[model samples]
Target: MDEQRKKGLEKMNEVYGWEMPNIEGDPYFDLTVDHLFGSIWTRPGLSMRDKRLLTLAAVTAQGRQDLGEVQVNAALFNEEFTEEELKEVAIFLTQYVGFPLGSGLNGTVSKVVAKRRKAAEKGAGEDKRANVNAAVKMNTGTSLDDE
Candidate 1:
């Protein structure tokens, strides 16, 4: 198993207080997570904004707001999408996903934005107090939340 998948499963287990039964019995497990998200998502062609928009649509259509919220945070905080960009994605989602989903999307986006911005400011203050020179060199090229 890839460490990424292992770590994801670990987190799930920790949260739910039980290991999610392995879906390896189903052959699509590896292909879905590994080939799709792991490989295709990491490719350079799609911008993070596009990915987040896609994720928002998919999650809303499928009624998976928890996952969507995480992706929203990844896009806004980790991928450095501006507030306008995030709003655009949420607005666009309404066309295919409907108004109710759009409202949930708005709430999810707002919640993540507030939480992440506060966390970032706190981290910055902590870094400043610690005199961590590396904090000054922000690597904005990629998502930092996953690692």
Candidate 2:
């Protein structure tokens, strides 16, 4: 990756708590990262959570649900806003933004939340299995590292 894009991706990952998607091959990724993220998103004035929320409202207002998905998922993964807080934002925004747009945003948020919850459950199951294996090993008198 180019230095600017790399820096932008790094900063985005730091803020979003997950790796950004397809930035390497995306043609417009540079514009978004270099201009949008590098210049605007990296600003110190607004916290990332605030930025995410603002972006959420702006994108949702424009009916850009496709783009909104990334912002929505990132907001959840970053733990910047609770689902309830997002719902409240939806309520207030709908007063100005219209019900259809708000409803679309709500659907997008629900999908992202469900996806994250499923992933968490899967990870928890894997952790449970690991702990059980460890316990069995301990009961049989050998540490996992011993063999």
Candidate 3:
């Protein structure tokens, strides 16, 4: 892999809490990994937590629960946001984004929390923080539209 692509893949994995493989040849994946993640995400102005909040809000406002779920799961897995904080985000967003969209986000938050809890329970013997990738994959699934 080229330097940018390698960097993108690592950033993508860190952001999403997944172990995404490098899939060459597809223009969409290539651009996503090389440009969006490599060039944009790695920029120094914003912290990862800040970027995640913006992304979560944007996706929630657009009624993209699938994407929102991914963000929520990542945030939780990475410990960027506590469960209570995520619940608060849903409530805070509901006011500006309207009840329907906010309600959807609230629901997404609940689902992600429950899934994480369940996974933690299932792997009671394992260290949840150490198995971030497995928990994230089980909860969010793999997707190309991560951003």
How many residue pairs clash (N, CA or C atoms closer than 3 angstroms) in each of the candidate models, in the order given? 0, 0, 0
Candidate number achieving the greatest TM-score relative to the actual structure: 3
Better of 1 and 3 by lDDT: 3
* Residues 1-147, model 1: lDDT tens digits: 767666545443332223343345334544444454455656688775566567678887777777666566556544557767777777887887888887787788888777757868887421221111211112122122322
In candidate 2, the residue pairs with backbone N, CA or C atoms under 3 Å apart (3 or more residues apart, or in different chains) clash, namely none
- The list of candidate 2 runs beyond 4 A from truth reads 1-3, 21-27, 124-147
Query: lDDT of model 3 at residue 1?
Result: 79
Worst 10 residues of 2 by lDDT: 125-134
Model 3 local distance difference test score: 0.81
TM-score of 3: 0.84
Question: Model 2 compared with the native: what TM-score?
Answer: 0.72
TM-scores of all candidate predictions against the true structure: 0.55, 0.72, 0.84
Cα lDDT tens digits, model 2, 18-114, are 5454234334555666776667788888888788888888988998786676667667666788888887877788887899999888888887778
Q: What is the C-alpha lDDT of each candidate?
A: 0.56, 0.68, 0.81
Q: What is the C-alpha RMSD of each candidate to the true structure, in Å?
A: 11.7, 12.7, 5.3
